[model samples]
Target: MEKEFNKKLNHLTKVNLARYSTMRLKSWGYLYELESFHEARAVIQELKKQKRPYRLIGGGSNQLLSSWEEGVYLKLPKADLHLLSVDEKKMTLSCDASTTVNAVLQLAKKYSLGGFEVLTGIPATMGGVAFMNAGTSLGEFSSLVSFIEWIDGEGNICSKEFLTSDDRAKNFSYRKNHFCGEGEVITKMILKATSRDDALEEKITKYLNYRKETQPLSSKTCGCVFKNPAKEMPAGKLIDGANLKGVHVGDLFVSTLHANFMENRGEATYEDFVALVQVVKEEVFRKFHVELELEVKI
Candidate 1:
C-alpha cells in the first residue's frame, strides 16, 4: 500500500519550505506537488486510508512557517493552469487554480480587461487569492468573483456562484471571504472584467506607483502582518503611531518603510517572527486599545 501510494504521489521528502514561502524562513515539511485533480483525489484517499493529516498551500505568499509534524503538505503546483476562457461580451475571465494573480493581471492587461488592474503587484496564486479573498484598499478578489469551483474533502468537485448584490456575498467583508468550505480545495474562479480603457490603465499605474513609494516591496516580507482594525483605522498607522517600527526580534525586523510589514534581515527564524508579532500586537493594543489580528497565516 505504501508502494502504491508512492507510485501515485508526485512528492518530495524533507523539503526546505523556505523555498516555497515568500518569507524565506527555514521550515521543513513533506511536500506533494499535485499534477492533476485525479492525483489530488488519490492523495486524499491515501492520506485518509493511512490516517495522515494534510493541508493545501498555494503561492505561499501569505503564509508564515515554523515546522510541520507528521502530515502531508500539498501544493496545487506553482505551474500555470489553463486560462480557461475570456468572454468579451460578458467581460469575464475564467482562470484555473494554479494560475498566479500576476498572471491574471497580465491577462487583464493583454485583453485590456480593466477592473483587475488593482491586483497587479500581489504575489499569490488564484487559489490562494480565492482562499484568502486577498485585496488592497482599491478592491478585493472576492468582490470580482462570480463563482468559485473547488474539490471537496470526499473528492467531489463543487461550484458556488455569487451575486454582487446578494446579502450573502456581502458577508465577504474586509480581508475575509466565507465561500470556501471546510476541507474544500479551490480549483477555479470566474473573475469579473471590464472593457479596456486608458483611464483604467492610468489607475493601475497610479496604484502600482503608490505601493512602490509606500511598501517595502523589494524586501523579504510576508506583505502585511496585521489586518486593519477598521476601514478608517489601518494597522500600519497604529503600529507606526505606537513607535514600533524598526523593532527586531533576531533578524526579523518591523520594516522602517511600512510598520505593517516585518522584514527578514538575515537568518530569521520562525520563533523570531512570532516574537516580533507578539511585541507589535502588545504594543499596539497597549498604546491604542486595539487588539491587532494577524493578517499572515501560519
Candidate 2:
C-alpha cells in the first residue's frame, strides 16, 4: 500500500517560493502541492520513513520562507478547497483545510451566520487560521472551532473535539494552538456558527475598512510581525513608541502605516528580514523593557 501511494505522489524541485509566501522572499526548494488528504497522508508517511525534513504551509499569509533547501515544503492546493457541510440548525460549518477565509465568509453569509465577520481581511486558509488561532481585536478563531480533522505524523487521520469540557481545548491560546503538532497537517475543521445577523455584510465591510486604514494591506508582508504583548500594549504601538517605524534592513522596511508589519519594498532577502527583526526587537525592549514575541512563522 505504501509503495502504491508513493508511486502516485510527486514533488517539484527547486521551485521558486516567493509566490507561496506573502513575504515574497527569493527562495527556492522542493514543493509538494498535495491535491487531497490521502496524498498528504502518504507524503507525511514517506517523508517520515525516509527521515527527510518537511514543512506544511497553508495560505502562506503568516509565514516567512527563508532557507527552503533545508526541507521540502507541503501545501494543500486550491483544488482541496471544499465546503464539505453546513448545518444551520446546529450552527455549524465543516470545510476542507485549504478553503480560504473569504470562501468561508461567503458561505456563512449565505446562511446568515454572523461571527465570521471578525475574520474579514485575514488572507489565510481555514486550517492556517485555526492552527494559529488567528484573529483581530474582534475575536480569535479558537472561539468558533468545534473540532479539527488532521493527518497525524504516522499517516493516520485523527479528529479532536474542542468542546469546553474537552481537555484539548486548553491547547488554544493567544495566536497559537498546540492541537496540531509538528508535521501534522490539518485536513478539515468544524466551526460553530452564530445566530443570524442581517448586518453581517455591513460588519464585514466595517472590519475590512478598519484593516485597510490601519494595516499595509497592499504591501508585500507576512501580516503582523509580532503578537500584542498585552491588551493595553499592542506590538505596533510598542514599535511606534520605540520609534522603530520606517526602519529598514535592505529592502525590508518597517511599515510606517502599521509598525507591526515589515514590508518587502523590492528584492528583499531573508537575511534582511532577520536583521530588521533583530533591530526592532532590541530597540523595543530597550525602550519599553518588554520582550516582544513574533506572531509570524519563520
Candidate 3:
C-alpha cells in the first residue's frame, strides 16, 4: 500500500512559484501536488521515512517565498475544495481545507448563513485561515470553527472539538494558533454560523467596500505585512505615522493606501521583500518602541 501510494504522488523539481503566491515573487522550488487526503497522509509517511522536510502551501496569499527553496512543498489539488455539508438547523457548515475563503463565503450566502463577514477580502484557503486564525477588526476565524481535522507528522489523522467559550483561549490567539504545527496539515473544518441573516449579501458587500476603500485590493500584495500590536494601535497606523508609506526597496513598496500592505510593483525579488520588511520593522520599532510581528510567512 505504501509503495503504491508513494508511486501515485505527483511531484515537480524546480517548479516556478510565481503563480502559486499572491506576491508573485520570482522564486522556484520543489513541489508535491497531492490529489487527496490519503495521498497527503502517504506523502507525510514517506517524508518521515526519508527524513525529509516539507511544508504545505494553501492559496499562497500570506506567504513570501525566497529566490530558491531547499525543502519540498506540498499542495492539495483544487479538486479537493468542496463543500462537504451544511446543516441549517444547526447553523453549521463543513468544507474541505482546500476550499477558498471566497468559495466558503459564497456557500454561506447561498444558505443565508451569517457570521463570516469578518473574513471579507481575505485571499486564502480554509486550511490557511484556520492555521493562522485569520480575521479582521470584526472577529477571528476561531470564533466560528467548531471542529478541526488534520494529519499529524506520523501520518495519523487527528482532530479537536471547540466549544463556544474554549476556541479562542485553548487553540487560537491574535493572528496565530496552537494547532497545525510543523509538518501537520489541516484537512477539513466545521464552522458554526452565529445567525441566519437574509441580509448577508448586503453585509458582505459593505465589508468588501470598506476593505477596498482602505486597502490596495487591486494591487499584488500578500495581505497585511505585520500583525497589529493591539486593538488601539494598528500596524498600518504605526507604519504610516513613521512615514514608511510608498517607500520602496527594488520592486516592492509600502502601500500608500494601507501602510500594513507591501505591494509588488513588478518582478520583485525575495531579497527585496526581506530588505523592505526589515526597514519597516526598524523604523516602526524606533518610533513606537514596539516591535511589530510579521503576519506574512516566509
Candidate 4:
C-alpha cells in the first residue's frame, strides 16, 4: 500500500525537514510534492483510506518542524502553476496556489496593478500567504483578496467568494486567516485589482527598505517569532524591553536586530530553538505580565 501511494505522488523519504523550513531546525519526514490541485485531492483521499495522518505546508517560512513524526508532509512545488489570468474590465488577477507571493506581486507590478506593494519583502507562497493573512502595518492579503478556491475537509473542492467588504474581513485578524480547516488546502485565489500606478515602484521600494532596516533578513530565522500582543505593545518591543536580546540556548539566539526574531547561529537544534522561546516567553510574562503567542506554526 505504501508503494502504491508512492506511485501516486512525487515522493521523497526520510528528508531533512530543516532544508525546507526557514528556521533550519533539523527534522525528518516523508515529503509529497503535489503537482496540482487534483493531485493534492487525490493524495488526501488516499491518506484517508490508509488512515494516515498528513499536514499541508508551503514555503515553510512560518512553520516549525518540531514533532513531524509518523505523518506525511504535503507541499505544492515552488514552480508557478502558469494559471495567471488578467481581467482588464474587472481589474483582477487570478493565480494558482503554488505561486509565490513575490511572484504575484511582481505580476501585479508588471501589469501596473496596485495594492500589494506593501508585501514586497515577505517570503511565502500565495496559499500560505492567504492562509496566514500575512501583512505588515500597511495592510493584509485579505484586504486584496476577492475569492478563494480550496479543497475542503470532505475532499471536495469548494469556492468561497467574498461578496462584501465585511464578508472579506470575516475570519481574518492580525497574522491570521481562519477560513480553512487543518486538513483543507487552498488551491487558487482571485485578487481584486487596483489601477496601474507609476508610483507603485517607489511604494514597494519604501516597504522593502523598511523591512531590511528592521528585520534580520540575512539570517536563518523564521520571519517573526511572536505575534504582537497589541498595536502599542509589539512582541519585539516587549522582548527588547525585557533585555532578552542576544539571549541564547545552544546556538539559537534572540536576534539583537529584532528580539521577536530568533536566529540560528549554525549547529542549532529544534530543542535549542524551543528552549530559547520558552525562556523569552517566561521572562516576558514575568516582567511585563503579558503572554506572547508564537506567530510561527509548530
> Candidate 3: deviation at residue 1, Å?
6.7
Q: Candidate 1, residues 13-88: lDDT per residue as tens digits?
A: 7778887778898778887887765577778877877788887878878887668878878876554455566787
Which candidate model has the greater lDDT, 1 or 4?
4
Give per-residue lDDT, candidate 1, residue 148.
79
Query: On residues 8-79, what C-alpha lDDT tens digit does candidate 4 reach at each position?
Result: 553445678887888898778887877667777878988887788888888889987765667788876555
Error of 3 at 51 (Å): 1.6
Candidate 2 lDDT over 34-135, as tens digits, reads 767777887787888778799888899998777666577887756354466679898898898888898888888787786888688999999888888898
Which residue runs of candidate 1 sit more than 4 Å off their true CA positions?
1-12, 167-171, 194-196
- Return the TM-score for candidate 4, rounded to 2 decimals: 0.94
- Residue 93 in model 3: lDDT: 90
In model 3, how many backbone clashes occur?
A: 0
Off by over 4 Å in 3: 1-11, 79-82
Q: Which model scores highest in lDDT? A: 3
Q: Candidate 3: global Cα-lDDT?
A: 0.85
Per-prediction TM-score = 0.92, 0.94, 0.94, 0.94
Candidate 4, clashing residue pairs? none
lDDT score, candidate 2, position 138? 87
Tens digit per residue, CA lDDT, model 3, 156-259: 78999998666558889887889778668888989999888898888899989999999999999999999889899999999999999999999999999999
